[model samples]
Target: MTRLRMGMIGGGPGAFIGPVHRFAAELDREIELVAGVFSSDPGRSKAAAGAYRIDPARAYGSLAEMFTTERARADGIDFVAVVTPNHNHLPSARAALQAGLPVICDKPLTATLDEAHALAAVVRESGLPFAVTHTYSGYPLVREARARVAAGAVGTVRKVVVEYPQGWLAGEASGKQAEWRVDPARSGLGGCIGDIGVHAFQLAEFITGLEVTELLADLGAVVPGRALDDDCTVLLRFANGARGVLLASQIEVGELNGLRIRLYGDRGGLLWRQEQPNTLTLHTLDGRTEIVHAGGPQLGPDALSRTRTPTGHPEGYLEAFANLYRDFAAVLRGEQAPLLPGIGTGLRGMAFIATAVEASRAKAGWVKLSV
Candidate 1:
């Protein structure tokens, strides 16, 4: 099989997610980094390219230059990964798609609902395979939870509670990651909600296969002088008559990527925590609890396909992220790939952020999602 050439936009030095994307993309050895416009600064871009061992000639100064040069090459990039801040996602993705390249982008789609809608329209017209990297959905056990819920093992999900909290922003944020996230101009209207709350929202909907019909959100800027919210709570109403609660805060005192989800149906409840990703707990109506370990015998094909290590060896964040890339590469190679989040997911995520922001501003009244 020919290795797919991949290019990236943004993720320069001091950027947190760029390396994570590189690690995950290379983990399966199905794709390779060939080109990038890593930063607005030409020097930084060249340095980042060198760090990735990309050919200097392929390291362009801008996305347009990279797209133009690569598209003219015999071995141009098969796809582009947009790992920039929220504001750049739309323009970067639009350029790549216009150049006839597929895109695998980070979450929340774009900085705002308008950009997301515009990009979604472009994606529809282009007919390219676009993916949104909702990393939690890539976990084997998370897939198992989704499968079980779909198979009626849980029997009609009634309620969901998902929370993602981190203390990193409990006081003041100073780093590049935190800086852009707390800035409205760079991160868009929904701050904490767009940052990590979208993950919690997406995970709940992904696992239960339910759509949020409406939501009431309460957002706060826990740390003084923060321009945007560092804490948020949302009440969700699912299309299937199910109700849910979502909490995402960066100001939680002792938290660290503390993302956890629990789905309760009429017959049972399922729980999965990001920190303890290797195992899923099931609580039945009869009071019996079962712990399903990753790489175990009871998992379905979807889960099995995502699991790499043995039952006890463990597969964590990077491996979960790699699953999306592996599947995306298969799709690019004209093979069948597992279901991954796509343009629709991206649109809905943006809509969620927009609706939450509006609802919060309106004193937390329930608001219907427009997506």
Candidate 2:
């Protein structure tokens, strides 16, 4: 199959997630970055494109220019990756879709629930493939956990506990990433919930195949002079009669990307940690436990398809991120690919963020999800 051409928006100089997106998109060599508007500033956009060795002609000053110019070219981008900050996600994605290109976006879909719903409507009207990069869901072991739960290997999912904690924002800082995340105008209604909390929420749902029906949340701005929450905890009720607890914090004092999820069912239970992503622990009701490793015999075809290495070889964050790009590329190439989080997941995540904020303001009382 021919390599699919791709373009990017954002991930310019000193940006964290932009480079991660570049690495992940090219990891499997199935897609190539042929065009981009790397930043809002024209100079930085040109420089970033030069650094990536993209043709200067393909580097544009803005998303509008990029979409218009690329669509007119004989060799246009197959899809556009929206790696901008949360505030720009909706506009950039809408532009790409309106230009008749597919989109791969970072979560939580948009800066607000209203924008998310509008974007979702555009996606449905356009009938193009749209993927939301819920990075953890792309892990082979995570897929295994999902498949196992779906097959009743853990009986019926009864409870879920997911937490993502980081200490980077524990104190007052003035970095670009930290600044925008704490600004309500840029990051939307919920801060911590919109940032890492959505990932924890999505992981629980993705693994257990359950939808959150109601939730109560406590959101905190642990650092001084912060306008948005940096720590949050939520109690969730699922449609399948299961219950869940979610905690996402950037003020844990000594944590570093520590994301972990545990699911309990009637017959058994399972645990997975982002720090130790290659392994999953399965526990039986009789006090027996088994350690399942990635690229091992126990994984089903779905997990194996996403795994790249042998039993002992390791795969981590970048690989998981690439798996989403890989599946999107497969879909573009007319190959059957496993389901990836898309517009629906993105919409739900935004709804969760909005609902959590509302619930927190009401003294953490329970609130039903509007979506």
Candidate 3:
């Protein structure tokens, strides 16, 4: 199959996510990075294009220019990856979708729920394949978990516990990450919730295949003088009457990228730790406990479909993210692929942020997910 020609936006010099996106998109050899508008500055954008070995003519100063020029060309980018900051996501995505190109963007969809909803409308109306890189969903064990839940292996989910904690901002903030994320103009309304919390929120819902009907959140700005909340705990109520709790923070001392989820049901319980993502723990009500490892014979189709190596080989974050790109690229080439999370999932992420903010602001009461 011919590789899908993909372009990038806002992943230029000193950008954290740009390199990550590039690495993931190129990992499986199904997509090729043909062009990009690497930065906001023309010089830096051109320099970034050179660094990535992109064609000089295709590297433009802004996303609008890239879209306009690409639309006129017969060999334009088949898809565009929006790796820009939160604010620029909507515009770049809108341009690509309207120009008859597919889109794959990083989460949280947009700065606000309204933008998310509007973008979702465009996707629905255009009938284009749009994928949001909620990267955790691509993990093999996570896919296993989803399979277990869907196959009735876990029997009626009763509760969920998901937590993500990082100590990158343990003390006074500095560097490009903290600078842009702390600013309201760049990051969305919620701080930690909008950042890593959305991942946790999406994981709980994605794995369980349940929607959070209502939630109560307690957000904190542990670092004094910070404009946004750096830590948050949310209590969730699912539409199926299940309850859950989510914790997201970037100020936990001594912690670095700790993400874990535990789901309990009437017949059994499932636990997955991100640090040791290759294994999943299962405990049944009848006193039987099992450990499921990746690449095992018992592995379901969802996990096996994306596994490129045998047992004992290490596959982690980057591999998971790459799977999303591979699957998305396959779908873009007019193939019948598995269902991928796109604008609807992105909108759910935005809804999570909005509900978390509302719940945190309320007088200690539960707030329903408006979506």
Query: Which residue pairs in candidate 3 have backbone atoms (N, alpha carbon, C) closer than 3 angstroms, thus clashing?
Result: none
lDDT (10s digit) by residue, model 1, range 172-203: 78889889999999998878999999999999
Per-candidate TM equals: 0.98, 0.98, 0.97
* Comparing 2 and 3 on TM-score, the stronger one: 2
**Full ranking by TM-score:** 1, 2, 3
lDDT of each: 0.92, 0.91, 0.89
Candidate 1 local Cα displacement, residue 147, angstroms: 0.3
For candidate 3, write residues 159-179 as lDDT tens digits.
999999998987888988788
Predicted candidate 2 versus true structure: per-residue lDDT over 63-157, tens digit per residue: 88988888798898999999988999999999999989999999989999999999999999999999999999999999999999999978988
Q: Model 2, poorest ten-residue lDDT window?
A: 330-339
What residue pairs clash in candidate 1, if any at all? none
> Which segments of model 2 are wrong by more than 4 Å?
none
TM-score of 2: 0.98
Summed backbone clashes in each candidate are: 0, 0, 0
